[model samples]
Target: MRRNPLGRTGIEVSEFCLGTMTFGSQTPEDEAHAQMDRALEAGINFLDCAEMYPVNPVRAETVGLSEEIVGTWVARAGRRDAWVVATKHSGEGMRHVRGGAPITPDTIPVAVEGSLRRLKIDCIDLYQFHWPNRGSYHFRKNWRYDPSGQDRVETLAHMEDTLGALAREVERGTIRAFGLSNETAWGTAQWLRVAEAAGGPRAASIQNEYSLLARMADTDLAELCVNEDVGFLPFSPLAAGLLTGKYQGGAIPPGSRRSHVENLGGRITPRVFGAVAACHEVAGRFGLDPVQMALAWAARRPFVASAIFGATRLAQLEHALGAAEVVLSDELLAALDEVHRAHPMPY
Candidate 1:
């Protein structure tokens, strides 16, 4: 439950952030409340949700339900200030959010207003672009990612416009800071460069899939975070439960992410099993729970400010929060580095 600075915003957030994408889909409202209560009791003061969430199978009918659930908790408990609430503006496609249109300057106010109305909150702590309108290589698209045809001038215009709108929100007291998700290193740098040149708020964080199985952030993203003072909010520190070793040996427990996503969003290939086994062995050597070790490993990264983890049940959340105090030793960290060298880029 250590608190870390969120970029240079002067805001401190819990090292572990509670992700609420499951709030209105896989979990009920009462259960979501219980998870939130448990997290706060365990010293997790950061919560992340989105305008389009409950997304195991994101649909139009259930869109925004996650925020509504969080809104209910905020309204009933009157603890909006107790947590650092972060949410996103979905990029495009999916047809359910914003009619499949990309996030634009006009859409910023509209999206923020919807989130405000749904969450019953006046301002957001960290508002992020779910992805770049130009598209991203994240979510297993790296193999086929191609940005050669993208127009840099148009992209810069978009960044300037987006930052202008966000600066307006800052003036209006609707958003405190901005972040990026599923973005490339160059894309993020342009946003930061423009924000600084325009005297607007700099992009404070980048949310991407970073775990034992997916180490794409270790190369360029990590360097950017170190140089820019931008925080890394890893979305799946457990590799969607693969690092927990629960899905080892081709076993899929009922109600697990693997049960629904089968391959854990293209993360379940043959190469991943060895990495999972190695991590499990590492945890056993240290007498630590695999789940806690996985989370703590991600949280203790030099560039990571917070590790975002989701739980469908309260017990699952409790297991994740236990990682808050599980500090890794130099010996264990070296072992992890060796494992990474052996099984880099499983996805």
Candidate 2:
């Protein structure tokens, strides 16, 4: 596996990151453990989790189950220093955590402590904010994303507040780096400016929905990452498995995300299937596996530090890991570009 710098944090992580969002739901603990073992054996050192995980069916009962499962593996394996662990702090609208309160200076220490206790680790390599306190355009909310209603003063003040708290955590050795999820270029720029002036920890990375089906990060965010040296952790590189060609012709497989999420987190639409067909056409035309082709394309993006993927079964994980060796050809790249131009935003 190829290693990439995690921004300027002096930490190197593998090109592929294993996502544990379904650790306790679609995947049991034993399966998740096996997935972790297989991923580590494949040289994937980046592991991503969150405070409020097991997201397939987000219930209060299963809020911290994913972290707990990962914690058990960490304790059982006793190889704490073998991988780079990344987790997130829940933000506003998370009803199960802190009474749906937004992330604040006071909540920072509490969230960090809870995550540390759950993951059974002394320190976190990358601590990310799951979403912005103000609001985010991610997860199919871009249609009604209204930034004009935001209060700039309060937003920047909140950024400064959280940055100071994170800086203290860094000084205390509870966390080594800070990052963001579902953040925009302007928001990330504000964070960088505040960190520079407040003497706080720099924003090391940004995790967002980026893949062949989702190309929102190919413009401003991509340029910002390149210029600022921020690691681009593209989450859901498979588009919730839409690009895998498993859900074609309205045939929903049993135990699949579509069976659980109905719309696959709002990814299912009349046009998205057409786009999927076009992508599969290109994949077939090149004699490549759709799964391997999608993963390889995502991992090779210009500003991508690592492409995050989640697997509910051992076979899924192994198949995704095969992309580490799959290389894309120039003609195939051109064909993909043609498909992208035809169906830019299917959803």
Candidate 3:
């Protein structure tokens, strides 16, 4: 439960952040509350959520239910001061929210109000743009990602306008920090430049899919985070449960993420299971639980400020919590590197 600085925001959060994407869907309210309690007791202070969550089967009716559930917990727990809450504003392509509109300056205020009302909080500790208006390469979209058609002028203008609106929110005491999600190194650099020029809040963190299997952030993104003082918050650090060894040998447990979303957001591929097997072997050689080893590896990355992970059950949360104490040795780290070299980009 080591604490790391949240960019230059002067807020320190636990290295392990509790993710609430399954708050109302895969997990019920009472169970969600119990998970939160367990995470807090284990010294986790950061809670990550989103405006459109409970995402196993994201629906229009349950768009904001996750925030409402967290709000109820905050209301009853009466210890909001102890938690560093983070949530996101969905970007374009989500038809259920804002009529599937892109995140523009005009939409910032409305989105902030909706999130605040649902979270029952006057201010969000870290407010992130869920995805860029210009799409991202995350969720296994890198193979088809094309940024060549992007208009730089229009993109810069949009960044400035949105940053201005976020500045207004800062002045209004509605948000303390700003961040990005599913963004690239170039995108993050543009955001930093725009924020500097506009005198708005600098990007504090970047939440992207990062794990042993997904090492796209290991180069340019890692450099950007280190040099720019931006915290790297890795989402799906377990590779969407692939690293937990539960989906190996073609076994899809009942009610698991695979059962709901067959491919686990396009992460499933013919080669991924083989890679998972290699990682599992490394974990066994090191005498570590595969789940804890995967999480610990992500948390131990040099640029990572926090590794976000979610659980539908309390036992899963407890198992993940053990990662806080499982430190990978140099030998094991080298073995993992060898495995990565052999099976890089499994999906």
RMSD list, candidates in order:
1.0, 0.8, 0.7
Off by over 4 Å in 3: none
The whole-model lDDT of each prediction reads 0.91, 0.93, 0.94
What TM-score, to 2 decimals, does candidate 1 have?
0.98
Query: lDDT, candidate 1, residue 283?
Result: 86
Candidate 3: the clashing residue pairs are none
Q: Write the per-residue lDDT of candidate 2 for residues 34-148, one digit (tens) a residue.
A: 9999999999999999999988788999999999999999999998887799999998899999889999999999999999999999999999999999999999999889999
Candidate 1, lDDT over the whole model: 0.91
TM-scores of the candidates in the order shown: 0.98, 0.99, 0.99
Deviation in angstroms for 328 in model 2? 1.5
lDDT of 2: 0.93
- Tens-digit lDDT track of model 1 for 1-347: 68899999999988999999889888999999999999999999999999889887788999999999999999999988998999999877858998988988999999999999999999999999999999899999999999998999999999998899899999999999999999999998998999989767899999999987788999899999989999999998888888878888999999887777788788889888888998888889989999999899888899999999999999898778789889799999998888899988888
lDDT of prediction 3:
0.94
Instruction: Write down the worst ten-residue block by lDDT for model 1.
Output: 256-265
